[model samples]
Structures are given as structure tokens and as C-alpha cells.
Target: MAFACQRDSYAREFSTVVASCSPAEVKTDVNGKKGILKGFHVVLKDTLLFPEGGGQPDDRGFLNDIPVLQVTRQGPDAVHFVQMPLNLDSEVHVTLDWGRRFDHMQQHSGQHLITAIADLMFGFKTTSWELGRQRSTIELDTPEVIPEQVEAIEQTVNEKIRQHIPVIVRVVSVDDPEVEKVRSRGLPDDHAGPVRIIDIEGIDANMCCGTHVSNLSHLQVIKILGTEKGKKNKTNLLFLAGNRVLKYVERSYTVEKALTSLLKNGPDEHVEAVEKMQKSVKLLQKTNLNLLRDLAVLTAQNFKSRADRGPLFSLHRKDGDNEFMNIVTSEIGTEETLIFLTVGDEKTSGLFLLAGPSELVEKLGPRVAELLEGKGAGKRGRFQGKANRMSRRPEVEVLLREALAGWQPTEE
Candidate 1:
């Protein structure tokens, strides 16, 4: 059975009687997120909606003002999934989303043009193809499609589009001899009725189930964006056709304008400007790290030189890192005094280090880590780890103070 969509791709509206309506659960994208759609599967006596098949998506439209979420072919019938159920056998007005249908037509037809030209020009048979949301891809049975070949194929495709050649759709019986003459990957086991063939007048004739334009000029233009590496020793050629090409150009221009303003350079110089900026940022980061290392040594010396220095010492630097904390501990020599060092935000997260008598450091490290909401490991006389609650440092200090009061150093 040939649905009205395949018979006349340009038909936008039609009247049909609902043959059946049943509860169904279909997968659909809701606001960019994938989710299950609980709906009713509607079958019509005749439908203008095209079901998903032959690498093209299903049609989106309306049935008596209710949105049709998806259309799928079940055996020989086109099943329309809708959120609201319609009374069975009721007459309903079906409206096709013209914009979506036309876009699919342009892309689908454009694909046939590119596929035919590639095969004729370079013996690159299309192993498979995908009609994507933004751009479509044709996977060629080859390892790579070089720039020169891409250019030639793209040129030929657009040339045919400009020639305004006629695109004819013919429906024939399954057993017809003409069916064997057209190109086909194969038909589904569930396929029934006649086979539909799409002929690009003198260019190519292939069996396809997707909707397409009536003439090559309807494609507007086809742009081969580039190629991507494909699996199983193949090359995927990326392309945009019709309005997609226009949208791509508009987006590219907008990005170029924004980059020019930010980089203070023309579009041609934008790449060079960004490269220079990255190099300068790297140099500045190196210089800042060197200064921090020197400051760490100075801070340690200041703590050691204190005339009233006690058995305990503590310091925190929000701008410092693990390397800075280790350097300060190294410079101060933690053999006599218990040292506590932290670097990063005072209220949130940071790294901490503790160094002192081997016995005392091991005992207090766990408790200190608990107060600071963290964990640490130690050996000999040094313990270090990351902390999540630097704001609780005062509590850790109190614990250290109590432990120190009861501690006695063993003679070495």
C-alpha cells in the first residue's frame, strides 16, 4: 500500500478516517532530553504523513489540532502517535508540517545527487547515509575522501542542481521487471505492496521510500562541509543543503564578528591573535609560580627567626598550592616544632600539611583531618592531604594544642 505521502510528496493537508487508536509508548525527544512518550497509536485509512524509513526521519504534523508526536510504519500501515486519542472511525483533518517536510525533501534529494555523482566520478559507492538534524552524512565505501575529490563531487552536485533537472517518482509492482533495474540496498522483510523508485532524469534511478523534491532546483545548493573518519574502512562525507547552507553561513559570520571584537583583529588574523594570547598567558603563569616559590622560602625564614617562637607554628595562604606548602615545611625544618600549613580558600577547600615528632604527628593527623573534613596519610614525621573545610582550622589548632601539652619528645 502506497501512502499519500509517497504518492504526492508536496501534499500538505488531507482528510482521512481514523481506522484505529490504541495506547502506545514511543521514545521521543522532549525539550532536548530523551524520554519515553506515552501516547496513542493512530491508524488512518489514508495518510499524508510519511513514516520513518530509508534513513529519513518520520513526519511531524497534526491530527484534528492534536500534535502527532511521531509516525512509524507497522507492516503496511503508517501508524501516527499522538498525545490525545481520537475516536476510532471518526473523520479527522491531517496537516503536514510543511517546513520540516520541505527540508527533508531537499536533503534527501541532495543526497541522491551527491551519491550518484560520487559513484559515477570516482567509483565511491555509498555504503550508508544519515539524515542528521543539522547536517547529513554519506558514508562512502573507501578509507578516505581527499580534498580534491570532495571538491569535484561537490561541484558536480551543485551543477546538477543548477541544471534544474526533473525528479520523477514511479511506483511499480513487487514482481515488476523494472524493480530489478534500479539500485537498492534491500527491502525490509515486512515490506508489502509496490516498490517506489526515485529517478533523477539521466543521472540515476534508485529505490527509496523517503520523500523528495520534484526538481533539482528545489535543493537551492549543496555544500560539502568536510569528511569524518568512519568505522570499517569508510569515509563519511558531511554536507549541508538548501536552507542549511544559509544557516551555516550566518552562524559562521556571527562567530567571526564576535572573535574580531574580542581579539582586536580581522577575521583573517583571528587565529594568529589567539595563538599569541595563549603563549603570553603561559609565560605569565610561569613567572607567577616562580615568585610564589621564593615567597614560600621567605615566609618559612620569618617564622623560624621569631625570638618568641613556640613548639607550634601555623600559616595559611589562599593563593598558595601544594608545592608552596611543601616548600615552607622544607625550609622551616619540622624536627622541633609541630608545623601546620594550608593553601587555598579559608572557608571552602584546600590542601594541608602537618609535620612534627613522628609519634605525635601520626596521632594528631587523623583528628586534624576530621575537623577539616578531609583525610590524610603519613609516615616518619610528615603527613599531608587535601581538606574540604579550611574554615574549621581553628578546631584543628585546638586539638594540636591539647596534644602538644601532654607530649614528650624522645631523645634521638
Candidate 2:
């Protein structure tokens, strides 16, 4: 999140003072009660400690042994909170956790680099940004960015990182006539203080209050993870930078090496190995289909041989896949024998009941479904239902026959 400092009549003087206080510490109250002496004071980036405004988390660190519970913006100055109270004139050394601060800087600086490169290379202007814990995202003005364009932009960002460009922070009065000429996305108009601007030398400049690295080279690398389409022509870019990028690379390499060993190939041959595996899977699927067709034929013949004089009924009991049940319902079901098949997996089960005499089956289908604690309807004589629990095959068959016997043809 970025904030525009309200420039007052003494804006120039404030800029000079704040610039000098690049890292300043002041006495503050702790525990939000009486003003007792606390351990030490802390310096915070003006934008870093905003408890309000944008929904960004506050910066937290320790001041000597005392913990800085929260960093928040109080008007123009950022207030740092501690567990213990502070005295009126207590003196303590203030230090900003350089590691945490540098991480934020690298992320912010990398965002500028990528956004700027995207604008220059692809004409995709960044509309807004969200800084998150693991990944930060920049929303672009356009909805669709081609994959190739993203790859190119990523390359450019890293190329710039390698160039080691200077990331300079400047504080200029909002009233400075030159300020209007500069293009910035989010600049607060009613600000009474000098605006802090981040300048990536030879690349981009924008009004931003977020802390940034002194140089782009410190970023090391910028990794574009992925992009998502947003409402009204916007693309959200997820990216990582600096140590985060290194961590991602290390983890990814580990996974790749494991996959290579499993596939018995080098990193370059992994793609080919996966493709071959996919082809093998397809062949196995074809063989399975053939076996299912053969089984359906044998089952149909067996049902025909056991045909009863009244109503030839055949119940094929099998706990198998849905596709096989569908094939059985389509192929074995006929006018002579009504087929009732039950399929079950580890978690749930399903039933497919098909019969001839379209009218009888249609009328009894819903009742049969109800008996099995399921619900289904169908045209012609075929019906299917998904059961919430495993149902006894005999009970279902009996209820189905009873329903069929009770069913009466109705005038359409």
C-alpha cells in the first residue's frame, strides 16, 4: 500500500527534516495507557505502519529486548507500539531490522521493475498492487496478457536486475510544479507533506511511500509465478523476488531432480518421459475398454440363458467404475431381463437400473430410486441413481419388481 504525504505550507522544510530523519526515533507511549518510560524507540517507514487505509499488515520487530507490537500511522508520523510504557524524555538506540526491511524493499523494488517493464514492453499499465507475505501481485489495466508476453517481461525484469540499476528515494513537495508532470498511480491529493517518490534509474519513477532497496541489483532475480484474470479488463500478476526467488528455485529443483530419478532421465529428458508415460496411460485405457466390452457380451449371454418365463430378471453385482456400469446398462438391458447393477468405491456408491416395457420402467424408476435412498428420473426405460450409502442388492431388486407390478399405464 502507498500513501501520499499531505504537503503543508512548510512542506519544503518538512521534506528537509524528514529526509535528514531518514531513520529517526522519537519518544512514544506504549500499552496505549499512561506515559511511562519504555525500553527504546523505533523508526518506521511512513507507509509501513498504517493500521488503517489499505488492508496491509503492520510491520513488527523488536526494539532491543522490548517487542514492537505494531507499527501504525498517526497523522503524518508513524507510531510504533511496545508492550511497556515509555517516559517523557527517555533516550534509547533505535534500529530497524535490516533483514525484514530489505525483504520488503526487494519485493517493492521488484514490483516496480516488473510493472515498468510490462508497460514499456507490452503496454500493460499497472492499476494497483497488493503486497502479500509469500507473493506480491500487481493488477494490470488489461485483462489478457499472452503467455509469451509475460515470459518476455519476466526476462526483461531479470535483465534489469542484473544491470544493477540504482533505486533512489526522493522527497519532493507535492506543490513542486514538477510533481504534476510526473505520472503516478496513487497519490493522495490532500497530503500536507512532501511526497516520497521511488525512482528506478533509467526505468521508472512513481510516488510511493513504501520502503525500497538502494539498488535494483539487490533484487538478484524476479520470478513471475503466474497471472489471473480479474474483473473489467485486469490481470493480476503473482511474482517473487530476491531470496524468495532463490527459495522457489531451490524447491523446484529438488522436485525436478526427484522426478528425473523416478523417470530414469536427466532434467532435459523429463518432458519426453512424461509424454511417453501419458501415451502408455492412453494405451492402457484402450485395453481396459476392450476388456469391458467383452465382459458386457458374456454377461448379456448369461442373463439370456437364465431368462425366466414371467419377466426375465438378471442382477449383475459388481463394485466397479461408473463407465463400466454405464456400458452394462446400455448393452445388457433389454425387454426380457431388467438389469440392476450396483457400483461402489471407497467413499460412495451408485446404481443403474434398466428394463424393457418403457411404460413400466418409467413409472417404477422413481419409486426404485427412493427405495435405495437415492433420486432419479429418466425417459424411456432406463434410470440411474447415486446412493448416499451402500444399499442391499436384493432389497433394491424386490422393490423395483414390486413397483413395476404396481405401475399402471397412464394416458399422455
Candidate 3:
């Protein structure tokens, strides 16, 4: 199907003939959320909605006021996917999401300018580009993009944007000699009909099938955020265009102000203050751990002196860490001593530990797990495991007390 974007991408609204409308199965998002994406693929006689292609996202809008969620090109057709079905012959009014469409225009057009500059200035061709919701990226052919070169490119591109360069889209023959002027690797194997060439006045021309702004000034600004090492040692240049740059600037200031208040330091000194605070926290954590170990030993001694607990002693401590509880049991146990300990409270589930006679360990291990919604094993007269149901701690305690009732300790 022929599209208006192939000629004039700035057309916000246009009505066209409906060639075909049918249900479709679409789940092309690479790392998308799980769910069946139900939509109707409507083939139009002509369209202004740019179908997702050539590293650009699809245009989102409405058809007869019904939401057109996705658009894609399959073979020769530009498929408009809507939530609800539309009549085959009805002339539907297509409305482009103006804000989203313009944003895409800024980024896609900005990318073309950047790609041209990078190739012309540094001989680094863009391998690919991603038009993200928050930020866009261009993957370059080279492993390294120096900071100085990035700055140079920024200076040059922003100058072009300020110049308000004219972007002209012209459809040409596939074998036309002017096609050689396009700074493209080549056309696609499945590509047919006239080739669309996007020419930035006095800057460069490239073959692409994505929507772009008519004037470079509409981009407002292009900010090269940073760069990272990408697949096969390529340099991925992170960037923001137009409203996204403004969005980033606003978020950065908000975060900076919040951090300044929280850390009790000016934005300039935040890094230094954070590093100093981290060092102090490490020292305090060491002291705190030593104190906890000492408290565990003292708690064990206090439990042993309690005449009310009898021989078969049991304890329940909320939010008790299992490893530290083991250390406590080591201090409290004797050959005849049987201690069943469960940790955590009703708000959350936690672990249980049982240390006792081998016979008792084997008998009660499975029972403790069953009561607390957990599982474990008994070894060397000790049984320990984690429980999933924290509120059932009391039930485990009741079951243990009933089992040990009328029991007499045998001679070791």
C-alpha cells in the first residue's frame, strides 16, 4: 500500500480507502510483557501512519475514533492494527497522535543527521538505532567514540539544527544514478517500487522508510547523553531529542534537589559526602554485628538459668536470623537438651530450627515442617528448615508441647 509518509511525513490527518480488515496475531516486542495482543490488521489504500520499520517505531493514533494500537509493514501492505473491527468499505478518518508522532519525527530525523555527521566526520557508520520511550540510541560501527569527537559532533549537529535545514523526501527509481548519492549500505532484498530518499539540505541524503520532521529546527535540540560498549564491541551512543531532552533535564534537577535535602550537602559535594557516609556505615555495621554475637551468648546463659523452662526447652524469637540462632543453640545445647526454635512473626514468613536427640529430631522434623508450611531434614540429632507460613508459628509451638508431654529423658 502507498503511504503519505513516503512523500510528506508532516501530514497529521488523512482519510483513505480500506483495502482489507481482519484479525491478526501480533507479539513482535522482543522483551515485551506476557499477554495475547489482540488486534485487527486493516490494509489501507493509502496511510500517513508510519509502520515500524528501519529502526523507527510505529505511529499510534485512531481510526474513526477507535484506537489504532500498532502499525507494521508485512510485504507490500502497511497494516493498521486497531482494537475493534472496522467495516471493509467504510472511509475511516485516520488521526495521528500529534504529540507522539512529532516526538518520533524529532528523534528519527535527529538520528539521520547524527548518522550523517558521524560518518562524514569520523568515518563511523551507524550500525543500528533504537527509538526508546525515554531515550534513543545509535550503535556505531567502531569500538571507541572518543569524548572529544562526541563534543565535536554535538557542536556540528546543533549548528545544523539551528540552521533550520530543510528535509526533503523524494521517491526515485530503484536503478536511478542518484540512488548512488544515498549514504546507505544498499537497499533491502525484498525492497520494491520507487526508493524513498530523505535529503537534509546541504547536509546529506540517506535511504530510509521512517517518518522525519520537515525542518531540522523542529528537533529543538539533540543531546548526546553518553556511550556504552555494545554487542561485538560497537559503541552505543545514548541520546535524547526534542521533548525527551527537556524531560531528562527536568528529572535531573528534581532528583538533584531531593538528594541535596536528604544527604544534607550541596549537589557539588554529594559524591564526597556519600563516600564518607558509606565508610562510617561499614564501621558501625562491624560494631553492631559484634554486639549481636555478644548478646546471643548472654541470651543463651539467661535461658539455661531459667528453672521454669525445664529440660525440653523451646524458644520463639521474631525476626531472628537463622545463622545467628544456630550460634545461640551451639552455646545452649547439651546431649540431653532438646531446643526447638522458630523465628519471624505474623507479618512475614521465616525459618525454623530444631536441635535435640536424634530420635526426637527424626520424629518432629517433618511435623514442624508440616505445621509451618515448610520442609527439612534431621542430621546428628539436629533438625532445621525454613517455614513459609509465619502466623502458623503458634501452631508449631502447640504441636511441640503436646508431643513432649509426659516424656522422660533417658540416660545418655
Give the top-scoring candidate (lDDT). Answer: 1
For each candidate, what is the lDDT? 0.93, 0.65, 0.84
Tell me the tens digit of each residue's lDDT in model 1 across 264-298.
88999998999999999999999999999999999
Total colliding residue pairs, candidate 1: 0
10 residues in a row with least lDDT, candidate 1? 403-412
Q: Kindly state the number of residue pairs that clash in model 3.
A: 0
Q: Which model is ahead, 1 or 2, in terms of lDDT?
A: 1
Residue pairs in clash, model 3: none
lDDT of 2 at 228: 95
* Backbone clash count for every predicted candidate, in the order shown: 0, 12, 0
Candidate 2 or 3, higher TM-score? 3
lDDT of 1 at 390: 96
Candidate 2 residue spans exceeding 4 A from truth: 1-104, 118-124, 127-164, 188-194, 224-239, 307-323, 334-336, 354-364, 367-375, 391-395, 401-412
Residue 95 CA displacement from its true place in model 3, Å: 0.5
> For residue 87, what is the lDDT in candidate 2?
43
Q: Give the candidate number with the greatest TM-score.
A: 3
The collision pairs in model 1 are none
- Per-residue alpha-carbon lDDT of model 2 for 1-412, expressed as tens digits? 2332221111111111111112233454667764444333333333222332232345454444456665656456566666554443344334444455566667877888888899888898888888788889999999798889889999988888888898877788778876775558556554557777678998887776666677888898888998999778799989998998887888889999899889998999999999999999999988987887777667666665664534535454454555666666666555545666666642346655555568767766776677667777677777777665444556767776776576555657
Candidate 3, residue 143: CA error in Å? Answer: 2.4
